[model samples]
Target: MSNETPLPLVMLRAVVSGGCDVTPPQRPLTPSGRN
Candidate 1:
């Protein structure tokens, strides 16, 4: 197999800790999926 790591475990930790360092974003990107 090739050599490439996944993007879940690390991402989860990074985001989890990152959130604690900042207030909630003004607002999430916003729901722009529906038409």
Candidate 2:
């Protein structure tokens, strides 16, 4: 939650505009698995 403090609104706007079909990873869970 700490990381989301700044861009929280951006995220909310994205989901609100993009709809529930979109999916985003939490953290340390890179899609490339490099972390």
Candidate 3:
């Protein structure tokens, strides 16, 4: 379980960081348009 846990944790962190960087710029555009 310990070994399996680290693998997914690393992948999730990578994906989360990537998504955050990509999403933040795009998010403002949509909300600004609505506002």
Q: How far is candidate 1 from the true structure (C-alpha RMSD, Å)?
A: 8.6
Which residue pairs clash within candidate 1? none
Q: Please provide, for model 3 over 1-35, each residue's C-alpha lDDT reduced to its tens digit, 9 standing for 90 to 100.
A: 76677877989999999987788676776664446
lDDT (0-100) at residue 21 of candidate 1? 42
The true-versus-predicted C-alpha distance at residue 7 of model 1, in Å, is 2.7
For TM-score, the strongest prediction is 3
Q: Write the per-residue lDDT of candidate 2 for residues 1-35, one digit (tens) a residue.
A: 75667587888978776763343333444464545
> Clashes in each model (backbone N, CA, C under 3 Å)?
0, 0, 0
lDDT of 1 at 13: 67
TM-score, every prediction: 0.39, 0.38, 0.50
Which residue pairs clash within candidate 2?
Answer: none
Which whole-number lDDT from 0 to 100 does residue 28 have in model 3? Answer: 77
Candidate 2 vs. truth: CA RMSD? Answer: 10.6
Worst lDDT run of 10 residues, candidate 2, spans 20-29
Worst 10 residues of 1 by lDDT: 26-35
lDDT of 1 by residue, 1-35 (tens): 13454577668868888875443453445544432
